[model samples]
Target: MPLRDLLLGLFVIAIWALNIIVIKVGVEELPPLLITTIRFMLVAALLVPFYPVARAQLPFLLLLSVTFGSLHFALLFIGLEHAEAGTGALLVQMGTPFATLLAVVFFKERLGPKRIVGLLLSFAGIAVIAGGPTLPSPLPLTILLLSALGWAISQLLIKRGPPIAPLALAGWVALFAVPQVALGSWLFESGQWQAIKQASWVGWGAIIYTAVMSSIVAYGIWYTLLRRHPINRVIPMTLLTPVFAVGLGALLMGDSLGIHKLIGGGLVVSGIALIVIKFRRAPRLA
Candidate 1:
């Protein structure tokens, strides 16, 4: 990668890392699913007008809406609402292994010894973290794991489905996902009108940051890099995201990194590193 593009990739990672902190703050003031609904609505509104969609991709978009936009973010934001930003960041790393497993099962891909060890280590790391005191409860961790699985599934779908422009994919998925997420908010959540009325500038700013910077700007740069560069070169750099997220969570949200977190997080990251080090990459989380 050229130096400028490398920096741009790092910039995208930085935006993604900080996004965890923003979502942490946003969920404190608003319902998690509600935040997803609003954030994606803004994302769609921003990008849909700029990109034309093909009718053939419409079915794929609907499926992606469920896996990527709705299930992924709905569970993620909900889990992050009660979980530490850093921990949530770490746990979501499971998406790598989750994707690997899916590929092996569905695509009949073969994993070498390294990947097997990596998978075991990743699960062991989650097990270690499950025993840690950092998490408020098992529920958030469980929810976050589900979110990661949704994300992994989405990756496979995108890889198999007809090719679409990155921004168009983002836009159409968000467009289709809005109603699914909105239904969740409407069903399980209350006082949305009151919450929207009462939310401060901080809450709304967090939403804007997520929709614009994290969703559009960051992804635009990232997809450009992937298109212009080799997958191996661009992929390894993404390992920095969780590391950056953890540090930013400490600095911005005053998240504590306990011994348990250190050990568990290390295992999880190392496991993910082992998985991603050799093989490939993706467009990143939605």
Candidate 2:
């Protein structure tokens, strides 16, 4: 890969990694659901203008929106309200492992021994993280895990659904997500009116970062790179996202890293690496 593209890829990862922090900050200021509602609203307003989905794809698109947009982000932001940003980021990595397992069951896909190990290793790490006696209320952790599963389910829906442009799918998800998320915010959360009225720049900045940088710009660059490069070359770079997030959380947000977290996080990232990166055989000699 060229240095320029490498830097660009890192830039996208940085945007996504920083997004964890932004989300943590945003949830601190405004209700998590409200922040999610606003983010989806902005995303829809911007992308739906340029990218439109086909009528045939609407039903599947709506399902995707429900899982990818509402369930995932709703639970994620809400979970992060009480969890550490770094820890939440680490837990979100479970989405890949969850997706793999769901694929095995739902799509009748096969997993090799290595992937099986990866799956076990990842979940064991989660157990370790949550096993600590000092662990807070299990509610946030459970919500985070469910959020990851929702994301995994969304990926499955995308694969099962009709072929649609990535950004177009994202736009439609954002557009449809607006009502679902807004309704949740209205029903479960209070003080939405006051949150919008009194929020500082951090809260609103989180909205812009998530809607524009994380959703659109980061994904735009990502798919462009995927088209130009091999999946192996591009996909492995994603492993760095959590690494960056952990560091940023500690440095920027002062997220505490307990001993259990250090061990558990290492296992999680290592397991994800095993699951995601294919170890190719050496070239054969004649």
Candidate 3:
């Protein structure tokens, strides 16, 4: 990769890492589902004018929207609401392994030895993180794991589906997610409207940052890298996100630097490194 592209990738990682802090901040003032809904609404409204869609894509688009936009964010934000930001960031890394497992089982993709080892390492790390005796609450761990699975499924769907511009796909998903989130807020958080109306400027800033930097700019740059470079090179950069998140969480949220985080984060990073190293050494077929 060129220095410029590498820098862009690093920038994306920074935005995503800080996004965990943004979520932590946003959820303090606004309900998770409501904040998520507002963010997606803004993203959808911004992208709709640039990327017009046809009626034929509605079904798949709706599915993508619900899975990626509504379900993913709803579960994630709620999980973050309960879990420590650092721990939540670490647990969400499971999505990569979960997506790999789905690809192997459903799509007949081969999980080579390194990939298998990576999956096991990641799972073991998650288990250690979740089962750590000092964890404040078990429910947050459970919710975050489910959130990771939801995101993994969404990734698999995106990989299997017809090719679409990343922004267009994101826009359609956001547009479809609005109703679901609104309904969820209504059913579960009836009084949230008043809360949202009284949200502070910090909360609004967090939402805007998530929608514009994390969603639009990060994803846009990521898709650009995907198109320009091999997946092996681009995907490994994502491992840095949680690292940044953990650091930022400690600095910003005063989250403790526990032994479990150090050990688990090490395993996760090492596992991903092993896979990338091995994959790079493998011979290519004609």
Candidate 4:
């Protein structure tokens, strides 16, 4: 990456890093699923107007919508409701290794010793997190990890499918996700209307920030950088997200990170470093 694009990539990473904190605030005011539904709805409203559909990719596109946009965000928001923003950021990077493992299993991709070590370090970090005092409970961590797995599966699908325009696909994914997420919210989450009606500016602002900044603007910048540079060069910049997440959570939200978090977060970042450094990388979570 050139200095300019590298700086642009860093800009996107900063936006994404702060997005976890935004989601944490949003979930506090609205039902998690309902908030997800609204976020996608807002994204769809903005993007579908300009992007044309790729009819050939509809099936896979819908799959991406459900797995990446719907299930990923739904579980993520729910997990964040119980978990801190900083911890959610660290744990979600597990998706890269999860996707690598899935590739080994289903696509016959090879994982060398270093990647295996990375996997162990990553999971061990999660275990340490489970043992730590920061999280509300083990259940929220499990939900967050499951969300990571869903993200991995989505990346696998995208890897297998033929190429499509990133923005068009993103718009379609948001459009398709609205219904799936809205249906899930309608079925499992209550007070959707009340939450929307009663929500303050902070709640609505968080939704707009996530929908516009996190999803549309950040992804647009990311795809632009990917086009301008090698994937490996651009990918490593994402590691900063957790760093920003942990820092912002501590500074703004007063979320405590004890010694265990430092140890565990270090292990997770080290593992991710190993994976991105030595091997084929996965597409990042949106």
Candidate 5:
């Protein structure tokens, strides 16, 4: 990657990292699901005008909307309601291993020694977090893990689809996701009307940041880098997200870091690095 691309990559990672903390702040006032709904509504309104017509791909797009956009965010924001932003960021790393396993089972992709080791190391970190004395609620963690699986499933679904414009896909997915999230919020959550009425400028700012910076700008930069370079070279930059999130959480949210989190987070990032780097270096199958 060029220096410029590397810098852009870092910028996206920072946005995504700070996004976790922003969500923590936003959900503190508005309901998480309502925040998600409004965020997607704003993005969808902005990009739906530019969304390419993909009538043939609408079904897959809807599935992507549900799995990736709605269910994923629904579980994630709900989990973030209770879990620390730093810990939630670490747990979301499970998406990589989940995607790997899905590939192994569904696409018959081989899991070489490094991937197998990576898988174990990743889960080992989870075990550490789970066994720690100061562990957060298991239910929230479980929901977050399921959110990761939903994200992995969305990746697999996207892999099966015809190539589509990144922003268009994001837009259409957001268009479809708005209703799912809105309906979910209406059914399961309360105080939506009250939240909107009482929401402060800071809370709304968080939503706007997530909608604009995190969703549109970050994804645009990410796909641009993928277009310019091999994915392996670009993918590793994401490892910085959790690191930034942990630091930002402590600095901004006063989140504590215990021994278990430090050790476990290290192992998780290291394991993900092993998987991504080793796979990038390995010979392509067939």
Candidate 6:
């Protein structure tokens, strides 16, 4: 990759990392489901004008919306409500291995030895993180794991199915998601209306940052890179996102650095490195 593309990818990673902080902040003022609903609403509004979707594609787009937008965010926010930001960041990295497994099972994609090794390293890292003394709650860990699975499923669906422009797909997904999240918030949160009314400027700013910078701008850049580069090269950049999140959580949220985190992070980074190295040497599968 060119230095420019690498920097752009890093920028995307940074935006996504900052998003965890934003979510933590936003949830302090608003209920998780409501915050998610508003974020997707903003995303939908921003993209709808520029990327109009055909009615024929509505069903597929709706599935994407439900899977990626509603289900993923719903579980993530609920998990974050109970889990520490740094641990939540680390746990979500499991999505990569889960996506790889899904590809092998559903799409008949073969995993090389390095990929298998990477998967094991990642799982070991997750086990270490989970077994650590600092885990907030067992329920939160379970929710985070399920959130990771949802993300993996969404990625596999995107990979195996119709080729939609990334922004367009995102827009349609957000559009479909607005209703589900809105309904969920209404059904689950009795105080949601009061919370929305009382939320401060800082809280609203966090929502805007998540919807615009994190979702729209960051994903737009990522999709651009993915369109131009090979998936192997582009996807590996995601490994840096949790690192950034962990650093930001420590700096901003007063999250502690611990032995388990250090060891698990090292293993996770090494696993992703192994996968990238293996992909660089192997021929592309037809």
Candidate 1 residue 226 Cα shift, in angstroms, is 0.8
lDDT scores in order: 0.91, 0.89, 0.85, 0.88, 0.89, 0.84
Candidate 2 per-residue lDDT, tens place, 1-286, comes to 8998899999999999999999999999999989999998898888898987778889888989889998798899998899888889988889999999999998899999999889988988888878753344789888888899999999888888798998998889988999998999899999999989999998899999999999999999999999989898999899889889988999999888788888888888888888999999999999
Which of candidates 2 and 4 is the stronger one according to TM-score?
Answer: 2
lDDT of 3 by residue, 1-286 (tens): 9999999999999999999999989998999999988998999998978998778878889998877877678889988987778788888877778778888889999988888888888877876765564354878777777788889899899878877788998888888899999889888875686887898999999999999999999999999998999888898888898999999999999888888887887787777666555443568899
Q: What is the lDDT of residue 90 in candidate 4?
A: 88
List, residue by residue over 1-286, the lDDT tens digit for candidate 6.
9999999999999999988888888888888989998988898898988998777888888888777887688889878887778788888777778888888898898998889999889888877776677566888888888888889989888877687888888877888899998998888887887898999998899899998998889988998998899888888788888899989999999887788887887787777666655343577899
Model 5: per-residue lDDT, tens digit, 1-286? 7799899999999999999999999999999899999999998898989777568988888889999997687788898999889999999888988999999999999999988898889999888877765456989888899999998898888888878888898889989999999999999999899989999998999999999999999999899899899887999989999999989988999888888888888889988887788443578899
Score residue 83 of candidate 5 by CA lDDT.
87
lDDT for model 3 comes to: 0.85
Task: Show model 2 residue runs off by greater than 4 Å.
Answer: 133-136
Q: Which structure among the candidates has the greatest TM-score?
A: 2
Candidate 5: C-alpha RMSD to true structure equals 2.8
How far does residue 36 in candidate 3 sit from its true spot (Å)? Answer: 0.8
Cα RMSD for candidates in order: 5.1, 1.2, 2.5, 5.0, 2.8, 3.0
Task: Report the number of clashing residue pairs per model.
Answer: 0, 0, 1, 0, 0, 0
Higher lDDT: candidate 1 or 6?
Answer: 1
> Candidate 3: where are CA atoms >4 Å away?
133-136, 275-278, 282-286
lDDT of 4: 0.88
